[model samples]
Target chain A: MSETWKAFKPYALITPQTLVFLLFLVFPIVMIGVVSFWEFNGYSMTPAFTLANYQGIFTDVTLKTYLNTFKFLGLVWVATLLIGYPVAYFLAFHVPKLEWQILLFLVCTIPFWTSNIIRMISWVPLLGREGLVNQILMGIGLTQQPLEFLLYSDFAVVLGMVHLYIIFMIAPIFNSLMRIERSLITAAEDLGASGVQIFKEVILPLSAPGIAIGSIFIVTLVMGEFVTVRLMGGGQSASVGKLIQTQIGSLQYPLAAANAIVLLAVTMLIIVSILRVLDIRKEL
Target chain B: MQKRALSFYLLLAFFCLFVLFLYGPMITIFMLSLQGPDGALTFPMRGLSFYWLGQVFQEQRVGNFIEPFVRSLLLGATVMAITITASVLASMGFRQRFKGSTVIFYMTIASLIVPSILVSLGIGVVFQVMGWPTNWFSSGLGAHLTWTLPIAFLIMLGIFNRFDPSYEEAARDLGATDPKTFWEIVLPLIAPSLLGVGLLTFTLSYDEFTRTSLVSGQNNTLPLEIFGMTTNVTSPALYALGTLTTIFSASLILIAYFAYTAVVKRQRGKA
Candidate 1:
């Protein structure tokens, strides 16, 4: 009895967290399923249930909006992977010293500290018509006039998102790459495996879990993307996030909730699909 | 040898360029803050005046930006406190076994993977309904608590998983009460995690744009203010605020690094 009392004492100390989690997190998610059915007007929510919001999203226009948002997100997702892969590869395999790796990694994380909004906005002066790039280009006689197509375009939106999220992609990929046994790479070379073949056959496959983690991180955030698309895409882009925001602004809670629920469904589907494919438990 | 050296040099060059890409826009914003609103990229920049920076401080219109900023900070601080407290307890509780503990643990895991936006929307809708039925409770703290609890649970879970239960057990054996053992032995050991998780929660809370945008009725946080300002193209003063915000944001990352190092070091020593 005393022995069990000893364990019980420690267990009791940690119960508050379990209680709070139940009260806040687990409870609200349960409520979301409930709220999705209820008709929410701005001021007061009606208890009446409807699945019309889900049905509405399947219409051609709304589906097209989702397609466009995914298309953009996918492009940025690929770009972040392509760019971040080399940085992680170099950091893990190429960097000679541990201190340099940490220093370089810290430098990569510095910009992320700034609000993503500021990071997106900062590009305006650099990419704007009379911005630094154009001024420099014109000064060097590379162009006759400021490039009007530079800022507030899909190009800028993709560029800014890639720049902001590439770090998120790199960190996980690096963690996986660092776990690779050094002698294994050397042995591949010793066995007459070419550098490219070793990467293709060994390094790339080994790092898939990290890539999956990073991709999900980027893609899920990208799915609910508002800041980059709004600021850089000039609000002309009606992203799922922006669409939900518009509804919320006017107090269209039911419609907004409906839209948000759709986004949530799509995002959860992607994460589940990725987790299934990666089977990350084995890697961990 | 030359080939090896060349590849090393190439990697260094790429790292330098990559770091530049990460930081270049921020440096540009810093520079632009000092420039006049004539949309000129002139080198002199009207002799580097703080005219726009001053405008952010003294102008009443600046309230639009400052309100959100202050609100974000407040939200961040409050969320930090809640997350640290809750996560630490969860971490401790997590160290023990009970009925449905695995289910509870998996629930925490699920929350971590579930998209923040999804969770935010779900909670935001629920809070609105629950809060609408009440004048005193629903709107303010209730809304924030919904998001804060999930994140704090996840972070505290990660921390507690890494912690050894022996120390706490020993303290309890020596006649410490449950709360006293947590406060004296367990809490001190996990202090760094609390700080790290607290900082991350604060950053996530402060920079939380989408969820706060949905949930905040009349209350504007820093992100919402920036959102509003960006829409109004007339104001270049937002650029100044961006510059200032950039400087302030670095502290979160610094806190994160210190906390991570402390945690990692402790883990290594134990191993």
Candidate 2:
């Protein structure tokens, strides 16, 4: 092959993958950014530039919704981390056999392949007023009335978010844990390191990239989340995503586009901050 | 192994609870779907019957599930083929230091983190501005690609990272051209993982909601239909539908896992 063709081959091979991102991702994002600056006439967007949409991000309701989203994001990130890290530690260090480890990990992740909406809906029967948890409580005479807050409150939103997103946390943390050299742990133990000391000094630091990736996944997903809040919160909550969805539903295109812009900026800000702490790409 | 530690038992118990937490609600949906005609959304299964399951099959108020299922199936298969092919190609290309590689890498990574609603709305608006009508195959297909490609890329990245390039060098030394080397050596080594990722891409597209929500343009995908049912149908029929679809997905994944495991074992044995 000629040197030029050889040099060009990799780019040519990647063109299809590159084109999809340009058309679907970059162009559309630029479109949203442009629309965010345009004026809305109550029905359609006109050509004039305006700051109203950007200004709306600071409005009381908008700010409150963003706060609520951040709350969910924080709760879900911490919950998943608390739950996921131990699970990864167990699978990576505790599991004795490779085959069993793979099997159990698949057991944890298999649900991820199914419909998330169905999984969310599945919670309705388990946590509703007349749901299984309440039934169990009343059946044991623990309550005079079924607890109403189990399904439609912020609790439900956080619970559903945790349930839905724990996988994102577990899979990555497990991946990082598995990649840790086994001999490092042996050496640490041989040097008379206690279990806790070895763990704190060795495993946690090595798994930081997995934890970072997991945190990014949970934070971004929870921040942009609307469906789980809408489903589990039963109109009792407001998220920035829901705000955008509502505005879009009402034909408020420019305002919704503006919300989209602010949301993107906020999401990117969180990710950038995370990247500042640890570069996830380097591990990859 | 050093006699299992006390901490191992504690962690084992915790892992058991974790698995129970993951699957308990799904089991409830599964059991509730088997309830008789008089059964409700919650417990107290009146009797055993397939009444709600049948109801899901012959759709009325919840809209036609079958058509949306077919559309999702088609979209998923299309996405599976394209994502696996594109990601496989790009994964190879990425091995070389091509121009704009960092930009493409970040873009793909951004594709994963960018809000799906934003993607849906952005693509929906782009189609409108371009005066191009969005269909499940056109705009919907593109939107699905945005979701699947990044994931496929990651999986391929994992597979190719552990791949030692000296194997390819040997093939080249044996007078194998680039295509011959890739097809003969690289493809065989990566085939099992590719199969798994392909199936995963198909399933992800099949169940995708947020990205496909605004892009599907009238002909709904199964996820859109199911989400609609969540608002309108409070009956046990919803559980029945969930049970069936979840069962189908579980079977597909379980089968793929075993098949992948078996292939890896056989490949190891041969080597």
Candidate 3:
């Protein structure tokens, strides 16, 4: 082959990916940014640029939606970490056999392969007013009436989000934990480090990357979430995603695009800050 | 070290509860799905039967389940093929030190972290602006690719990282041409990772909803159909559909696991 052909081989090979990425990923985001500045009338969108969409973000509804989204993000993040960390810790430290570790990890991951929507809705039967939990509570005479707030409330929304996203937390944390050399812990103990001391000084710092990655996943997903909040909150709650969806449904494309761009910017900022803290490229 | 610690048992109990928390709702839905035709959505099954599962097929309220199921499968397979091919080629390009490699790599990561709804909306708007009606095979495929290709690229990076260049160099030293060496040596070595990537991309594409929702145009995928039914259809038939899709996904995972293990075992035995 000629020198030019040799040099061009990699670019030629990458053309398909580049084309797909540019057309689908980069171009669409650019389009969103462009469309956000465009004008939208009641019936149709126009090409005129304006800041009206950005101004729309200052409304009480938008403020509440963002606050609600952040609230969900904080709640789900802490819940998933509490649940996920211990599970990942147990698997990484306590599991005596490699096969058993793999088995348990796979068990946790199986549900993740299924539809998240199905999994979210599955909570309806368990948390509904006449559902199993309420039935059991009443059956045990624990309450006079079924808990009305069990379903279609903030609690249910958090529960559903945590259920769907906890595995994302576990997988990354488990990976980071597994990567910690056994000898490091052994050395810590040999140097008279207590269990908690070893964990705090050694294990925790090393797992920071995993926690950061998991947080990125949970935070971004929660920030942009619509379906879970809509379904579990029973339309009682609104999220930025839901707000954008409403705009889109109403054919307010420019306004929705603007909301979406803001959402994207916020999510990206969170992710970038996390990436900065951890520099997870090495871990990846 | 051989003796079990007290903390181990506590952790084990916690792990068991977590597992139950994860699988409990699924099992509940599975049982509810077997409820008799007269039964409602909640527990205490009026009678145990496959009536609702049957209803999933016979009922029109489920919104063309069969066609959408088939469409999702076709789309999954197509996306799987494209993702594998594109990722393999891209990973090859990535192996070399190129001028724009970081740009491409970051773009893939950006594709992943960007919200799916935004991507869907943007693509939908783009299609609308161009007077092109978004369809499953074209625009929907493009949308799915935006998600799957990034994941596929990352998997390929891991695969290629572990790949030894010495083997390819040895093949070239033995007078094999570049294409011939890649086909005979490199391809075989990476076949397992390719299979793994294929499985990953397929499952991701199969269960995909948010990205597909806007670009899917008139036709619904299985998840989209189920999402629609959640609003109107309040019955065990919904659970039946969930049970069925879970079964499909579980079986795919099982088959892939077994195939992967068999290949590993055979390779180990030969070595």
TM-score: which candidate is best?
3
lDDT of 3 at A171: 93
Which of the CAPRI classes, incorrect, acceptable, medium or high, describes model 1?
acceptable
- Assess candidate 1 and give its lDDT: 0.72
What TM-score should be assigned to candidate 3?
0.97
Q: Interface root mean square deviation for model 3, in Å? A: 1.0
Compared with the true structure, the alpha-carbon lDDT of candidate 2 equals 0.88
Global lDDT of model 3? 0.88
Better of 1 and 3 by TM-score: 3
The top-ranked prediction according to DockQ is 2
lDDT of 2 at B136: 94
lDDT of 1 by residue, A98-150 (tens): 98888877878777656888888888878877788888999999999988777
TM-score of chain B of each: 0.79, 0.92, 0.95
Error of 1 at B111 (Å): 3.2
Please list all clashing residue pairs in model 2, or write none if there are none: none
Task: Put down candidate 3 lDDT per residue, B171-245, tens digits, no spaces.
Answer: 988999878988999898888767877887888899988788778988888888889989998778889999999
Cα lDDT tens digits, model 2, A1-284, are 57998899989888999899999999999999888888888887776788988897888888999899998888888899999999998998888899889988989998888998999999988888898899999999999899999998899999988998899999889999999999999999899988788889998888999999998888778877888889999998999888888887886778889998888888989988998997787567
Reference-based lDDT, each prediction: 0.72, 0.88, 0.88
- Of 1 and 2, the candidate ahead on lDDT is 2
Docking class of 3: medium
lDDT of 1 by residue, B39-67 (tens): 34323254467777877876454354655
